[model samples]
Target: MNFEYSFEKISCKDVENFEKIRNVTLPYDYKQFLLLNNGGKPIKRRFQSKDGKITSSLMMYFPISESVEISLDEKYKIYSIGKIVPSNFLPIGIDPADSLICLSVSGNDIGKVYFCDMDYFEEDNELKKEFISLISNSFTEFTGSLYIPE
Candidate 1:
């Protein structure tokens, strides 16, 4: 695993403010992580792709502000709720191929992380419905899945 962290840890106040502005409650496990370190690259970066055939690694994990920024920026173009990705799914990280790793914030799947294929969604309109795939049940589980490759 090769962890490359870049931001300082955020304070509880920052988290609270972020929550208020975003209007979404972050999962407990991920909230704890944000307090420890705002955002960066994870060490055990690889995960199963949405197709279940290939593997992928996280490109970057957005800080709270960055997450909000990207979510809003891409909302209409790529991640609009009930369009490409789900409404409550906020992008947390990206893959080498620019696919998104999202956290479900509002729906029944809240707290679960997902691997989303943006390319597939953009390329095939009919496939948009199947763009997202589950990665882990929680942030802790996602971190625990990281491993150093030989």
Candidate 2:
């Protein structure tokens, strides 16, 4: 499977469009994050098959800063320096913050979306693939976000 992703900023105008999907998938906290960072440029990537049918997707977000010093502080780490939005959250009309958005568009159907610290790469990678497979095979939609508190 080819995993290609990007990030884009979410604008205030995009809120309702985002909410359309958010209502079905994301929780309140995720919505808050989107609203707070809509002003900045958020990364966005498109995932589709060779035939052009997008089966799955992923989004990553970055923070905004008025000054270099303020942006580079420790607080950046606490928030989604990497705003990772799941495929289930896609077709999202919101403009994301200005940051790097890593995305993947796959042929397999997506089930659940998980958000973990970047450090959990190995586990997230393995699980992401597995979740894709599960959704493809069963056509089941896994709801909710799995937050591993830092």
Q: How displaced is residue 33 in candidate 2, in Å?
A: 0.4
Q: Please tell me which predicted candidate would have the highest TM-score against the true structure.
A: 1
Candidate 2 lDDT over residue span 1-150, tens digit each: 111322244554455553353343334443445555532322233322223232333342332233432221122232222233343323222112222212222224332232222333342332233222221211111112111223
Q: Model-by-model lDDT, in order?
A: 0.70, 0.29
Lowest lDDT block of 10, candidate 2: 137-146
Candidate 1: 10-residue stretch with minimal lDDT: 71-80
Give RMSD (Å) of candidate 2 vs. truth. 14.8
- Candidate 1 local lDDT, 24-110, one digit each (tens): 788988888877866677777777743466567887787755445543334423553345567678777788898888888777888
Model 2 global lDDT (CA atoms, 0 to 1): 0.29
TM-score of 1: 0.79
Return the number of clashes found in candidate 1: 1
Query: Best candidate, lDDT-wise?
Result: 1
- 70: Cα error in model 2, Å: 25
Model 1: residues with Cα > 4 Å off, grouped in runs: 49-51, 65-84, 123-127
